[model samples]
Target chain A: MARSLTKAYERVKNIDWEPSYISAADKYVEATRFYLPKKALDPFKTFIREYFLMEREKESRHYALLEAASRLQGSNPEPRWMEGMKFALSNLSAIEYSAGRQMGRMARVVAPMELRQGYMMQVLDEMRHTQLELNALRHHMRSWQDPSGYDIALKAAGNSVGAGIFRALAEDFSTCDAVETSLGLQVLIETAYSNIFFVGLSSAAAQSGDQVMASTMLTIQSDESRHMANGYATLMTLLQDDRNIPLIQEAFDKWSWRGHMGFEVGLSLFADYFVKHKTESAREMSQRWLLDDFYGGFYKKLAKYGIKEPRWLPDVIRNSEWASHTAAVYLFGAWPVFYHRYDPIDEREMEWFEKKYPGWYSHYGKFWEAYQQMTDADAGMLVTKELGGLPAFCQVCQLPWIFPRPDASTGSTIEREGRTIAFCSPACKSIFENDPNHYSGFKTFYDLYDGWDLADVIVDLGYVREDGKTLMAQPVLEPRRMWTVDDIRRCRYEVTSPLRKTAGVSAGGSPHSAVP
Target chain B: MSTEKMWIEERDIVGVKLIAGEEAEAAAAVISESYPDAVIERYPAYLSIEAPKEVVFDLRQISERLGRPYDAPTFLVIMSSYHGRINVDDDRITLSSEIVRPE
Candidate 1:
């Protein structure tokens, strides 16, 4: 009665033809080092008609929920998560859009019909994900009690210092080899790490009383399996030739570190910091999803093909121990620069953190104590200034060098062509060394605003509300008196680059690098 | 087959994470019926159905259990994430730790 999907997919794939007018090199603009065989597997065997029908059904269901949520205005969403969404959704939408562009690039350069077909569907999936995030953002903007941050979300993704991490990630994957992009993004990020964000944190979203975000994350994650299939198909095709093994290994090495720093660290922050009622700590989630599931379950199987564990797996394990806490410190320390309303972790949360991460209070306790004291605008103390200013962002990862723990930072500095470049870890340093030209051109946050006044930087970032004077960011969710541009000016805090101050220093000489 | 040639490992666990809802409950019910050894872990926001080595989702069975028509695409809507290699046809979707060699 109905045409078999496998037969239809095979028939559709047969339509692909070799062009006589142009060479294969010309047709595929980007060249990959990984050898791709002509034959590839499409495990899903996705066809266009079925794909559209499926996507349409999913979209209708999602939009219907969105409509219901809008009309009903039922749940009392946690303000902390709602505020965090301004930052999270902004970067997520941009990342998804970048992923869409990457899919287009992969579809063009990758020769296999099956892989290309999957990539085409993924292009639409990425676009849909972006729209879904934007819609969630729009809903929050319209519904949330505080809308200042949501209004400038897209703008913040471009300018916010913390957002540089995600931007670097998107840029790295988009610019790398087409096949490597699939490995980095789909296989590593989408398959391995995204569950922490989409599934694990979607639970956090629900627990935080944001059903819309929960729905959005779950729906977006549904599409990721297909994307993962696409990556697997490509990897399998490449693996058919023995020549591609080393190249694949190298890509895995670089991306494992990159994906951790750029993506997982941020998700960890959201999980640990954003959600009010947290079930699992970021460390615990990493243990379950990343270490146990991805590595033990999926990657161990790849050993048969001579694919070894990622070179940076041990380093990633070490970094994951303290990544979220360090990230939380960075975000809270430089709260004025970001667009979210932060709710400082209380005694309850502190106890939880210490329980989850043993001895957490020893390293971070003082900072939170200092943060609480400085919340009052009348105190004339900016926490950024109090904490001896923000550390230098790694040239490659775009995260601060004060990682794992600021006390025991794995960060190092190298003098390249008379300019000093900082790296968060040896992995990032090795990545930079591998292709100095690729990462060298990018500028850090301090490079742009080293000597500028704090107020001026905020104004320049356009993180101010409609009044154009009051900052969109507040020290706390609800302050007795909101800190304005004038309040920041009153504090007289000047932006200083740690890299600029310690230019020629070899390694681990950064000031204020002692917090975990 | 020799151990080295075997794509599937003894410790390999295939799983599907479904958004917690009536549909997920129904799917879990169907899966538990077929794979008696399946481990179903329920969370606040999702249901995790895991089986060692391999698991299969037959839409026809799911439809019958759901008391309505269900399709592969609709099943995908509930499944947020999965572990192990996945293969999907119109009526059936299989997740196995074993890598199916390409023809």
Candidate 2:
């Protein structure tokens, strides 16, 4: 009865019933990248055209992303940019650019005619984001330094930031089909972190006395929210096929970790150190936006649809308080070599950290005190000489393996492709294990170190000065200054004063100790 | 893996958390009057308001306090965060976390 089934299949293929020269594997992706080709079949043409018009109509409001970003419209708040602001602009610009690239790729990779519209709109939204962020940078830069600083920051820091975005969108690069790309890009990155990145950043901005930036960021968050809704709608459609649940859960685990890694660095730079005047620490903001509002309200509703939470949710919840704080110290310690300003936590600020974070003082209080003494001794301790090498990088997030100490860092170490690769956390390890091919072979800072001298590694990451020094402080303009003892001296640490006795500080814990 | 074990029938509650602001002083007064039995908890920079199972944010009352038109959606910006499903309209925003069973 089943005579020659293999031979029958071969005969059927030779019969040439296929639609076109394009193989079945490549058709859907090639066809749906943007608008379906004018030559494509009947209803698809009409549907794509109609959907395009609707998306254009929806995005008409995105122009408001620019005009004085403060809530009270037409208030004409002055533009301001500091070292932290430069760091933010650099990191944000890189992310927005990567977002546009990812969404454009999503449009090509997604197949269903019904879903193409959402990906297309997200493509437009990401473009609008690029424009909006540029406008913010330009507006503030007019009053700050050279016009070329923008170009310099982008070229210099693009590698690390772009690499982070690339690996974060690993599902997009590696998936055999479309489901995970949309979920990772649209739902996790835009939906979850938008609340933290845009909403929480705006709140922090407003409290720190820049009503302009707050308003602008809030306006951007709404567009991001709409994108999230579109993603949620896509989830609804995917749920119609029960087979998709397991795939969705897998994508959630892979991506939410990367999203967590990304925002931890971006938000903490601003919340913890950059904006001296504080509103919410990164932990509080995560609990507010991601945990309380997002999980409590949004994801709780998704339970009715049978989508379980990410498998790594326990680690995500437990580590939320310390991850960003740890990142702040790591980035701060790395200083001019790293991509942000390193503002020392003054005495009053230390008190606030203890009060706000509870265990924060026990966790990072000693490190900051050590940083204080290091500064007092050299004043420019961050200069190229004192830092022996970069911290060991997590293979997944590209962040340092700098989780809070006194506990072995919780990242899973895996033997993959004959090498021991380290991850920053269990969540990151799961992401790597999900598909090692997507993450492997990329240059970590460790890889960079392996290839070049430490100074060359610094220069490769965009820290180069025209004088050929690898360590240049930010606000990268004509008068490129190095971090001085005076910069450390200004903060109210007693060690900074020559009159005070320097005693009872945990002298430099070798940077190697922080490595996982 | 599920909230069933942690769920308490007696302690069923709905809550809204908001950051401290100029309007919060006036807004809190109006919100308290509506849910007189609601418990309000204040932290360093934010405050939380909770009732038995549902709490209504009256836009009419909020508008009267602020002396201007108020939109339910704008509360998203003013409030830091909230728990429970929120349904909004011109008149009110209701947040409810209770489970409903068929008779």
Candidate 3:
């Protein structure tokens, strides 16, 4: 007969004893503002031995699939999805590694035995997730026909301007209060946003013929339930003290917006734009997974404990209407700056988008038309230059000011210490206002490359393959002539900071005006 | 904008998303048998099973349906993700909308 898990867990709980030699403060190096109680729930009742055995089984199963994928070399994956993986996998692995570091920090500072035990397992889980993504990157690099983008993925993730969005998110979660990190990462991101990525997008991955990625996403998602439980356990432990309610509310308010802008926005972009054979729009996925499942199912229950809905949920819902289209504009417009081969959406997809979004074609049709025309390198046209240059990126979200829609942007600007700072939405502005110092230090894409030439910026980012002259990013997946450094230099487009031009401007300035 | 009350419907739906496979099919069969009200939605990559208020998965029943010896941890292997408060004992895993208080 099997041993009772409840009894085993109870016995395991007895093993913790206060150290006589070291004080609690000295023992736990970091301090969290959120109060943690002595007791917490570990619903999984995870034993380290069982955890390893379970994980080992999972790893063997996933790796066996990967191994088979490598040996069998099945159907050709969709080039659009394959190219997008260069950007997605790179940022994902970095985020996972940062999450692993956060777990270690949380295990140290959080006093509860159950939560800490869960955190310890999560630490390993995160590390495994990181390696799993890196392995996926390696697999794609080895197998994918055009390996230029894959070859430079990790480096590009560090240096590319678009990747700054993910970096800002990872850094924000990494540097915040340890317990707050739990709410932001585990409660909000892992629970709500990851479903869209792992379950929803993995379907897209399978449809796009990337079985390896589908397997990778599903396997990674298996670990997230435990992480969600970790967050729940921590939240429940914190709620025991009445003092923590307001603090919890504050954290929820901030992270809800932060997670949406920082994480969900990017995933939405991938879902709507990357997958060639689309199963669902980003809006539909958000409606189902985030709005219906997370907000409706989980968050409503939190009201019993005095936790209200996040302050920025309305804005989140509003932004969801056009977040993907705007993000698509940013990535597509500034193609040279990124590290992916572009696949512009066709008439079929545009019709699909219009059908799904109602007015998507009217708002975004002209841009796609111009993009298709400008794909020829011989034409000496760069779409980034033609679109009156890229707009100013929001300092808080690290996305461009033209979000939701370029024509009707909710983005605003504020002056702090005589310097102009832009925010994508009222939510972001409020987040920055909460802790000006925390966000004030972040440098935007324009900050780094305002005066540099377009060619030099790409060259400096090291977004080039082994043959250093050919650029990693192209206007289209397979261009008639690949736009090299020389080709970009011919365009003579210099990178200019939109914020610099619009300095001293008030809150309601049009993002479109700054484009030129 | 929709009202918060409208968004947060009174129905406390609890769900588990399992990776699409034989295990998911078997689990879905057991769940349908156990909880007649369970709604199983099939997607290309996974199976989404939702029930009103609560859903219980008995590993013994699942194993019987699968014609193999399945345990709780192995059951977790197929479960990609889930929402609602989760409780796992030796032989069963329960997903409930009930708020569990700390001891």
Candidate 4:
């Protein structure tokens, strides 16, 4: 009887291949084939490899939970990792909302039946990610309240140091054409930039002993790898014809820079500030994955295919040294919104900075030193005096106009219909120029605060307590808490000065390189 | 300044870290078969087996070494931390850094 059942299963394995029976060409168009003629495309003999792997993703959850349990081994949550986890959890809704909607949209417009089938799995994976992240959050929330204030945080929370990038990601999926969206969101964002989280950030999650964060990220990454491949397949299939070259190149320029905007901010802040230990600098990881591998290696391979480096490459490489440091200075002031206590850059970490990035201290250290001096004088005063005022805004990203070091950009702007629109750089201007209908006249964060004071703006954005004056500060639970002004001072003390925070485990390496 | 970069070059390399046992040996062997550059680092409890960019754990290869049937989902059980995205299916698994753009 079992043999008969196996025979029945095998009978359906051979799908109808005759072009007469609803040909893939007549009924379904290749997603990128609009740019390339059908003759230019490669024949897909079997289902794309990504489609098959996603089918297996259905079983990944069974193992993800067990793996989390194995790593936990009945210990309490590690406080620092938990803090980073909370920030990760708070930031989840933007991507979750985008992925869920985009995948469903993809099924409609995406031409090939197999490609659409793969996106169906991605839709499930994105929804699964939402649930898994919620589970991870719930596990951590058992010990403490969800510090994200995510429930109350504004829908357009791009009002601060970095959250804007997450907020902007929605449009790439929801509005862009199939080819553009796949190349941008799936290829550049999902495949390329995701390593910062899955490999680099996830490793930090593990080292900090938050198995739920680590395992959840790792499992989510399994889906990403396939979805990424699906995107890559589209690029390769389309690139087979030179007619599609310019179309793909344009996409490569725009998305690659935009993909890294929030990424530069979040990953930098996470690595430099939030981790239990400084295992790797954000700059070092960016240098490896972004420079040495992605551009130096993978993008180089594409040169033969006639694709140029992203238009923003030079500026990105220049800013790689400065992006995190630029962000860290501002983020320290915006700590409540970010949902983690800011440990003032410690002396050793500063030394780590100087060693890892030459002349980094000269470029950014004085700002840290000045902030430290201000905090030392009076922590309460530092918030009101220094961090007040609108640091300029970029028309495109809506993030603070932080670039070119030290002072904020005076900003280049175009005269438009009686008003001037300011931009952080020419690349942002060029990106804006490409689609003025969709992009231009969008309000920067500065525009949102037309008449309100900074504190009132924060209050309006739900960053205030019921009492009104108290900004809703999220506390780091251990390695010391952050309830009082003194605790804030103590957190700074832990990072810097004569008495520095010691590594709980060995500093040079982990007990097991595998686990590390 | 000695001028040697300190942070280990483990950023986007993909492989498995397994508790030392026959399973570890099986994993290491399968990895070595596919990638000549694969290396193993020994610690107190586990073996850190890795290949640059990615490591493939072909279910057929690993199962042949272990003398048992293995599913790709079982990677979660064996790996402690992997440095690249994980792609798995019935026959093969690729721990790929570049997301495997089809040639």
Best by DockQ: 3
Which residue runs does candidate 1 get wrong by more than 4 Å? A501-516, B1-10, B100-103
Q: Each candidate's DockQ score against the native complex?
A: 0.34, 0.06, 0.52, 0.17
Which tens-of-lDDT digit does each residue in A1-516 have in candidate 1?
Answer: 156887777777777789999998899988888787888888888778778888898899889999999999989999899999999999999999999999999999898888888999999999999999999999999999998889888988888998999999998998888889999998899988999999999888888889899899999999998887887788888888889889999999998889899999999999999988877888888877887778888777788888998998888988887789989889998899999899989899998988888767888888889889999877779877866777878899999878888777888888778777888889999999999888998878877898899999999999888888988999899999988999999999888766564445633356335353
Estimated TM-score for each candidate: 0.96, 0.68, 0.96, 0.76
Model 2's TM-score against the true structure: 0.68
Off by over 4 Å in 2: A1-26, A30-81, A105-114, A145-151, A161-177, A375-388, A404-407, A460-462, A465-471, A474-512, B1-103
* CAPRI docking class of candidate 3: medium
Give the CA lDDT, 0 to 100, for residue A473 in model 4.
Answer: 52
For residues A1-516, could you state the per-residue lDDT of candidate 4 as single tens digits? 112222332353333243677754555443433363322111111233433453355345435665556556675555555655545575664577577778777665655445655677678778877777666655565644444443443342445434665666566446767668778887777766776666567666766766557667766665665566567666776776678888888888888877776455566667767775676777777776566545654565677788887888776666665677766655664454454434566787888878877877777776676656544322333431343333445667655555545353424656565555656667777887887666664554545554444444555566554454444554223322224333333333211111111463222221111000
> Which run of 10 residues does model 4 chain A get worst, by summed lDDT?
A507-516
All models: lDDT? 0.86, 0.54, 0.87, 0.57
Task: Give per-residue CA lDDT, model 2, range A60-131, as digits (tens).
Answer: 433443443423444433222255665566667666666666666655555444345556656676776666
Residues B13-99 of candidate 3 have per-residue lDDT tens digits of: 898999899999999999998888999999878899999999999999988988988888888887899988999888999999888
lDDT, residue A26, model 2: 74
DockQ of candidate 4, scored on C-alphas against the true complex (2 decimals): 0.17
Q: Model 4 off-target regions past 4 Å? A: A1-80, A145-161, A336-338, A373-379, A407-411, A465-469, A474-516, B1-25, B33-36, B40-56, B65-67, B72-90, B93-103
Fraction of native contacts, model 4: 0.02
